[model samples]
Target: METPASTATAETPRPVDRADRIRSIDVIRGVALLGILMMNIPYFGLPEGILGSLKFDHPGDANYLTHQVIEILFSGKMRALFSMLFGAGVILLTTRKEHSAGLSIADIYYRRILWMVLFGVIDAYVLLWTGDILYAYGLCGLFLFPFRKLAPRYLLLASLVCFGMLIFKGHLRFQDMRGKREAYLKVVALEKQKKKLTDKQKDDKKAWETVVKNGKPDQKKINDEIKNVRSGYPTVWAYYLPINTKIQSSVMYEVYFWDVIGMMFLGMALYKLGVFTGRLRRRGYLAMLLIGYGIGIPLGWWVHQETTLAHGDFGRYLDSHFLPPNRMTYDIRRVTMALGHVGLIMIIYKSGWLRWLTGALAAVGQMAFSNYVMQTLICTFIFFGYGLGNFGRLTYYQLFYVVAGVWAFQLVFSSLWLRFFYFGPLEWAWRSLTYWKRQPFRISQPDSETVVSSIQA
Candidate 1:
């Protein structure tokens, strides 16, 4: 009789080979991974307090313009694309497993995601990056398995529902903030007369004051945060951990969960509809590109214009975010921009003119897991206190120099690394842990099939 080890080997599901990888998905993933850095770099290099506020730059400044470009073109769009790609990966993985005779899908699936959760914790805490999305992705991924087999239409419906929930939640939060602001103003008017304040009135006044302070951050707070971020590792952790905790807890559930899940469902729907597989006609992609940008760009511009008009007015800034038009259209702008980006990328892929560029992008996408982590490591060393300590030193446009440097390095490194190795280091490790076995590491001389697989991907 065969031993238990042999039986387990025979039953265990294996990772997909390079030959089976979808080039379009890989290209998309690569683009999304790189685009994410455009937004994340500011947080890494600047004091957190100054972000999304007019504290750092006057209106119409070059720095402000740089921010506007990124805010409109990339910002949430990249992350949305990332979330959708993850959703597509779910479908891709399970669909492949359907033919894996004797394999336990749930056993493999849950184990994979659980390990991702562990990795996410490591990415956030150990790596000291508060903006890590792996944890949120892993958390959202748990619910995706059950919905894998749903039809495209049903998936689309579910996605819409999730997006709708986010809008509803935004409205409710806006109402609460508006009420507090009104109360605070009323208390202020009363105080002008030197009248006694009720306890509730005092509390209301305090709450709105706190909001104002956060929204229109003081220069001293920014300076102090800069100093803290430029300190040693322990000081950095202590200063930032509460931020991490709050983001991982309340913010994750309230905002990221719905945002991520909605994109995920949309991704699954698009995958079933062949959006990422080059199955959609060229004209179809063109329409998506046109329509997506047509709707999203103007809306994003309007929102940004209105918000920027607030300048130093805390209440007006709050109104911009939580009030009509801007509040309601946030999801629409992000989603449509994300889809528009996809269309543009897909059009490029299908055109097949820039083989050299697309090939490099595909390689980067293949090792996106590694590249993402590498970005964290490289950036922390470049900006954190213990390393070069360039935190808060770079201006907005100047930050992109760092981004470009990183992009060049990753593109080259990912392309070169794959030539010698079958998988990226982290990808290899993740696969090993998920399957509970060591996996092949180095690439051998390629056969015809391997070459074909490489070309196809």
Candidate 2:
């Protein structure tokens, strides 16, 4: 957020030094960043496919132990927390510049996102996994451009609709899966009526049992699991019609894109309402937490559980069904959970004790651009093709080592770098590119008193 005075100082070439920067947002960003890795660490430690599995798919004593720890601790919740921060940041940065004299809000905002799209592409293609949210976020930011200036209530309504649409779409999928519920009933009924369970029942019993108590994800087992998803599950898109596929594409785009935008708008609205400004009453913040937590978590957990029950089972017979069954119930829950993420932020912010965690987190968030790339580079070195080639090899528990190692590295480096510069290196580059000027990279400043004396002489 370049202020009017800051813009003037830039034009006159007043050098920015250590004292000129704001610590609060940087702290906030750093906190958000640290939390992101807590979410990403498991992915780093495991094969990519294990992301949505009911059970850790790989085998071996070492890998099996790894999976359990990750599922229990670093699963979905932390990432959801990071997404809320991204939303808050969108508002924080944009609003800061909105009333400034130099960079037009529209100009800087669009250029910023355009640059992010390029960055996301490169990150996706060359650095790490192609499943990059940054690219989706870049695209989604465009949709948010027009609504930035609408009245808060209007923006609020728009965001709600987009989010609600996501929920509705999920509901439709859940309903579709319900028709297949009868199949499960038949299998269970048949097994029970026989007075002895068959092989199919045994397999299901296996799914319910959670194999981890007995095993770990070993390379040989991972190879087998990968083979299973790729070969064992036949590619029967027979039920996945072109229209439905298109619908899916659109739904996913909205799901990833709009959930983020909706949160940003909500944050922006909150900001306008003076929440982020620290003006909201304690009760108000408390109320938000209660509402979000009370409503969101249970709803989200229900969705997660239902979806797992409904469509988590992959069957040779389901070659007839292309769409996943838990769509709708789960979708509704994701939306509520996302709101719950906001509630979490408020709770954390209100806590004086959380300053330490938030400080570490903000350090990461401040260098998100750099840290995000760094995460990929380090993980690829640890797991991917170019380095150890350990993908599909490490245990789920071993993931913590990777995560802890990376967290230590990022924390030390981000703090060290901030000491010498106004922005993270990538953040500097982004701002420079967006402004289309060679912004100063150095923080050293000329003596103003000396210049004044010289002018008087």
Candidate 3:
């Protein structure tokens, strides 16, 4: 007869192996981070309206083309990828310390989230632009821990509920626009046919021209945008209120949480299926990737196009704001496109060609906590009065250059930092503060001393 402890050990799955750790997650995160720069670059350079306007008009055919390319390439995809990663992060952290008895895990987690919220509030007011996701993410983190033990099917159902509800909400809005009939059809026709913008349309062109032209933003633009951000822009304050922001950012932040958690479940399922660290046969994942991309990308593209149109609903939606709010098609498509991007990341991870790309990217991913805060710090200097003070001056195209510089800085710094230290600066500090004990800083290795562990290994 087997004892209960021995019986339990016999049935339990093994922990993830050191060599078996998944790089796909890191790779996907890296790609998402870079892709984020594509969208953020514009904000870093231009005015708020420019982000939306570029979709409809540009300075010329070239500018129009540039915006279109970015829309297809970056647009909604990166954010979705980040959201999925956020979901995955929850699973990772929960498991990291599941067996450790000496740690006050829940207390530590609560403090970590509190610190995150504190940093987010500080970042929003002092240094960076008010388009802060950190604050939203931190608030959401508080509720995520409880979901860690949910079964896969249940996880899938929750994700679908979160994602599907958003789409359903969007579908009604689109249906309403179709009922109005004239404006919706006209806008679609113009976009599909690629009609040249009339003079009036030219002035209304949307693109990030501000940040590119100005290295930092002019003080005036910063003050104006901040005011608009805080005011939530013409009833925008309603958008940011805890109630409305919760709903508005619900799909934006929490939806990603669901998707990511779903992916972690998917990843767990895949792990059970034998995929990570080369355990799964290439052909298996290859088929899944191909099939997934084949369907997901085009579908993503279509929905993305649809959501772009939802912005047009602003006036109509506002006109009837007093009534039960009208739903729009744009919302429906955002969910569809977001799903497509998730499929794309899954496929890319399966490709196996992403080793170098994933490795460097994982470097950034490993230090994501640090890089995230670093992004706030760096962008503040580039965009706020404390630094060059040129927030709303640069154009969209010019932002690419600044991003390149930052990318170079982050990549090199991340790689170098990892060599000398065990964690990114902030990450180390976060751990120390959370646990109230200083973790070891360096590993003493009797090495020919490789470049990998530079600080004190």
Q: Evaluated with lDDT, which candidate comes out highest?
A: 1
The positional error of residue 215 in candidate 1, measured at the CA in angstroms, is: 2.0
Off by over 4 Å in 2: 1-28, 48-84, 97-103, 178-254, 296-357, 445-457
lDDT agreement of model 1 with the native: 0.85
True-structure lDDT of candidate 3: 0.55
Put down candidate 1 lDDT per residue, 351-390, tens digits, no spaces.
9878777877888899888999999999999999988999
TM-score of every candidate: 0.92, 0.68, 0.67
Residue 62, candidate 3: how far off, in angstroms? 3.4
lDDT, candidate 2, 1-457, per-residue tens: 8798777764542223333333344454454555566556655555544543423333345544444333332344445445545555566556652233466778878888999888876675445444456776677777676665666687667667766776676656544444344445556677678767677765655543343222333556556544432321122122113423443356546476666666666655655666544466667767766776676555554443444443334333234345543443433444444444444555566565566555555556667788878887787566544456565565455566777788888877775565445567888888888878766664454365433221111
Off by over 4 Å in 3: 1-22, 97-100, 171-280, 300-355, 443-450, 453-457
Which candidate wins on TM-score?
1
Over the stretch 1-457, how does candidate 3's per-residue lDDT look in tens digits? 8998866544442233223445556555666776677776676556664555544444355545567566654565566656656666666666663323355557767777788777666555444444565666677677767876776566556655655555565556545534444343444567679986565444323221221234333567655665444332233233234533453356555344443343444433333334333454556556645554465456545544444444444434434333222223332333444444545555555565555555667667667767876776787567654466565566566667788888888776766665656566776776667666675555345253534423111
Over all chains combined, what TM-score does candidate 1 have?
Answer: 0.92
Order the candidates by TM-score, highest first — what do you get?
1, 2, 3
